[model samples]
Target: MNCKEALPLIHEYLDGDLHGSEAKELKEHLIACPACRTLFKQLEQTEAMVRSLPPVRVPDTLTAQIMSGLPPMKKSRTWTDWIRKHPAVSVAVVFAAVMFGSYMSMWNDDKNLMVKGNDLQEVIIQGDTVIVPQGHTVNGDLVVQRGKLEVEGDVTGNVTVIDGSVNLASTAHISGQVTKVDEAIGWIWYKLGEIVNMIGS
Candidate 1:
């Protein structure tokens, strides 16, 4: 057994969820590995300290004070119970609502420049231009909306520029395709493509 596997089992053991062979294997790993043994001791001490603390009970007056503005009501089930029973459906509905809100705000004839990407740590933002500086590395896909993209360094994924210009320097290194979208329809398609990719992933 390795420390990687034993680490999780240590938590399981602390939670009293581990048993039999899995627990035995973790014990052996802990005994063989000095680092794992030290970590296990620390976690064990933390757990013991936590268990030693007394349970907390919230005051009823505090709850009433927080709920003072709300009208008194009887316990009701309907939508709340339905949501509880169908959590997946509720989650999908909420996600769709939030996405719709974001879409409306983003594409409602606004001229504000926006940039979206999973990795923008290496990107430098100027007034109207986004620059990937030389010698810096952008680790993932980059999207520049209503602005300019000046690429001089390494980009590990796709680069998309919308309603803007992209200037690639001689030393720029891009591992994926680069696309420029100009028209409103093209922007819509780009957004749809992003949504599809997000869902697929």
Candidate 2:
């Protein structure tokens, strides 16, 4: 198969969704295609890094709020009446869902907090390095005054940074260029020290 046809199948191959013969065909194609091999490796690494982070437990209160807002109903009521009776209830439920979703969307690491695709207004890369993982498409520009950056996803807008280095991942597709400045020196120093300690250990 040609590269274009084989490209979409790569995901299936990695997911083990292919039949034996199909799998063999794709494997053979990958061996001959350098670009596809590199892409496969990058995707594998991204998945591994994302999985390594501990799962964030949704707060009990938040979960309770969500469940409570959802409020189970009796089977007797009609759909229209249920919606009419719970007009406020429905709105509350939707709001709660948004809150829960937003909380879960953000990724917090020791060095920097990477926010996944969300309705984030602006991002300021202060002290530590912030990484936008692959497959996370941001709606707006990433504003970093100072800190390291790794963008693996597509940003719909421009990237502005003051004094930090942007290390774009091979799979990254940025729609805008990066801008830098030199305001947050203390944070940078602290971040550098932490990075050094981590490397040494």
The lDDT per prediction is: 0.65, 0.54
TM-score of each: 0.45, 0.32
For model 1, the run of ten residues with the poorest summed lDDT: 102-111
Worst 10 residues of 2 by lDDT: 102-111
Candidate 1: the clashing residue pairs are none
Scored by Cα lDDT, where does model 1 land? 0.65
lDDT of 2 by residue, 1-201 (tens): 777777556656645577787788888888999876766664444334334434333334444554474676554443234433454443343345356652213323343344333333223233366666677776655655335777777787666554667778899887866555456775586467549967998
lDDT of 1 by residue, 1-201 (tens): 877777677778877889999988888898889987866765564455334322222233433553367554333323233333333343343345345532211111123566665444466666667889999888777788888899999998899998999999999999999999999999899889989999998
Q: Which residue runs does candidate 1 get wrong by more than 4 Å?
A: 1-111
Candidate 2 stretches with Cα past 4 Å from truth are: 55-106, 109-185, 188-201
